[model samples]
Target: MNQKQLVVRHRLRELMVAHDIPSVQELSRRTGIYYATLLNFYHNKFNTFNNRTIATLCEFFDCRIDELIYLDKKELCGA
Candidate 1:
C-alpha cells in the first residue's frame, strides 16, 4: 500500500506580485505583522502557522484562507 502526505504551501509571493507589493518589509509594515515573521513565511521557512498573522494577512490582502494557504497531497514509500 502507498502512503500519502499533505504538504502545506503558501501563495504569499504570488499574491504579492499580483498585487504589486514590492517587498516583504512593506507588507509587514502595512499589515502590522512582524517583519521577521513575514520574512520567514515569505521564504517558506516556517514550520507552523499563526492564526492571527494569517487573519491579518487575509484582511490586508482582501483575500480568503484558500487564496493564501493550500495543501498538496503527496505519496510516500513505505519502509
Candidate 2:
C-alpha cells in the first residue's frame, strides 16, 4: 500500500499583502501576537499549530481557517 503525508502550509504573508500590512512587527502590533510567533508562521517553520493563534489570526484577518492554513499531501519514500 502507498503511504502519504499531509503537510500544513501557512498563508500569513499572502494575507498580510492582501490586507496591506507593511511588516511583521506591524502585524504583531495589530494582532497582539508576538513577532517571533507570527514570523514562524509567516515562514512556515512551525511543526505544530496552536488553536488560540489560529483563532486570533482568523479573527484579525477576517479569513476562514482554510484561508489561513492549507494541506498538501506528499507521497512517502516507501509504500
lDDT of 2 by residue, 1-79 (tens): 7788998977888999999999999999998999999888888789888899999999999999999899999788767
* TM-score for each model: 0.87, 0.85
Instruction: Tell me the RMSD of model 2 versus the true structure.
Output: 1.8
Q: Looking at candidate 2, what is the lDDT of residue 16?
A: 93
Quote model 2's TM-score.
Answer: 0.85
Q: Output candidate 1 Cα RMSD.
A: 1.6
Stretches of model 1 off by over 4 angstroms after superposition: 77-79
* Strongest candidate by lDDT: 1
The CA lDDT at 42 in model 2 is: 84
Candidate 2, residue 55: Cα displacement in angstroms equals 0.5
